[model samples]
Target: MTDSGALQKFLDGVVVDAAVFSLRPDYRAVLLPVDGLVPGPSDEASEALLQAAEASAREALAGRTVEDLPHVVAWREAYKSFGAKPQRTRNSLEALLRRAEAGLPRVNRLTDLYNAVSVLHQVPLGGEDLTGYVGAPRLVRATGAESFDTVAGGVPVVEHPDAGEVIWCDDAGVTCRRWNWRQGRRTHLTDDTTTALFIFDALEPMSDEALQTAADDLAAHLLRLGPDVRIVRRLIANDMTHPEGT
Candidate 1:
């Protein structure tokens, strides 16, 4: 199937188990499936964006700490709800904030851009290579049977999420474990990815307007990546709201 077709199909099958909502009714995600993008190593443009994000992070935390940030506080509680230790396994947003004091990793153009955007909006965002996914994406409390590919001691290894730990997965296995703590190697974005999926995770204190603003900022940056870039977005929550493109 084409990129758009596959994304639409993925959206059709997207499921956030009711149990997950029961854990945190305020939890929501902004799923953006985009195609027709060029990809390359991190360049000066991405570097500039990253620098701006670093400054933004510093400004946001000038007189405060990551744990004191409202969004980070909300996410920490959310992680605890699903049996994960927040301090040990910080959410993506907290992880980025902590790293911003030094410098963010310059992975590649796409990854760097999204990381910058995530930091800019103070939201947890994840980008994946759509081609690496199997079946449709799902958010559920893991049963400990799904495989999670990763590197350990510089060697590749497979692990599983703890039973009842919230995870993002597909038919093949887990794509992300502990909600947003870590992304699997299988679906991680790389320089070769032309079509990608970006997920923005939000919780209480992050208004819908704020989430939409973040999504809009991300889409704007994405459209500048390539001439033919196309994006479709949807907000998945109890109401299952969809943006215009979706």
Candidate 2:
């Protein structure tokens, strides 16, 4: 990896400063490709696809959002969940993949950077748009229709009742997160993200080798973007031990 002046420091911060989250015992690690783009699964092909996706994501973002959940179900039927009900915006979080494959656009370097990584890794990522949390930044689950009001345009609703997990930021109920496979229109990444939480999700905890590669690759990618970037690892949890606990 070529060094790009202050980029080394930025790479350090992006990997070190931010916290990371893992899936709950209830959820299983599943390899989710960029939605709509992920081909049907075959054990052999799925593994290769996942690896390739991870490589791409690392190339662009030097970070990733661990993706879990297979599907959402209610009564006896299953439906797609996009963190919010009624569809907040026209953009599908999956669009990031398509965009990345086409090269990034210039809309605030950070935003483009995040999308690049999101697409490369084939994982859905979410974060603060530089405006702190409007509600709470908690990774909670969807209970029912009455529990999902953050992005419903004032419409009270519930998130996915089965499978899948979501980031239930308290600031806005469920403002910005990857629920059921798409990003919310409410809180998106913006140009002004000085301090933000970068998410990395997976069906299972990454092997140490994979983690190291992820770290190295991400750092390399960040170096290419410019400089003065900081990346640290942050873990968010509620055990009283705190996430960065001993």
Candidate 3:
């Protein structure tokens, strides 16, 4: 299928808005829509990619700690600005880089691949199962009223973000909390996911070119899942007055 055909069908009635970027002018996000993925256990090619990415991450972390990394440090500050404790709720990139020092978990093909890319590029990346989304996915400062679905103890519980906290949400609830620290269980990726939405988040210290390269690398790795996979991407920046298609 063509790019437009795939994106139009997958994104039908699904609007993704990055409203937080308007206020936090230093923020940048790149959205990647992918279709026709055969998600399952990692194949030989994907395994090799993950291995190489882990090795690269280890080498990159040799002399410096995660806190010393420019991108990680920027994200920590961003979290603090919004009332999040970076020491407790570390950003996704920091978490992944730390895990890579020991070993990255092999969750599934898509998750493993994105986790690797996040570590390799030193950017916060998230992959959500698009099919599980209720409506639009938005990044906005919460009003302490938006619902967030997560697990409490052994049971599923519904929670809400603190007022003015930066979060990613849909009509159903928050998808990610504190920018990239925690992802809700509602729209998480799984082995059954066929279509996916990947978010690449960057801050001031991180350049646009770096974000683009990370997205490109992710798309390339995702294509390894299947032969007929199609991908489309859009870059949302602080300079844009309104989000695309809004």
Which candidate leads the pack in lDDT?
1
lDDT of 3 at 223: 82
Residues 1-246, model 3: lDDT tens digits: 345575756555443344575546678788888888998976676677678878988788788787998999999988888888999999999988888867888888898889888888889999998877777677888999998889989899999899989988888889999988888897889888888899999987888889899999999988877887988887766556334522
Q: Which stretches of candidate 3 lie over 4 Å from their true place?
A: 1-3, 6-19, 240-246
Q: What lDDT does the true structure give each of the candidates?
A: 0.90, 0.37, 0.82
State the RMSD for candidate 1. 2.4
Q: Please estimate how well model 3 matches the true structure, expressed as its whole-model Cα lDDT.
A: 0.82
Residues forming the 10-long window of minimal summed lDDT in candidate 2 = 30-39
TM-score of every candidate = 0.95, 0.45, 0.90
lDDT-superior candidate, 1 or 3: 1
Ordered by lDDT, highest first, the candidates read 1, 3, 2
lDDT of 1 by residue, 15-69 (tens): 8887898899788888998888899999998999999999999999999899999
Candidate 2 CA-lDDT value: 0.37
Consecutive 10-residue window with the lowest summed lDDT within model 3:
10-19
Candidate 1 is scored at a TM of: 0.95
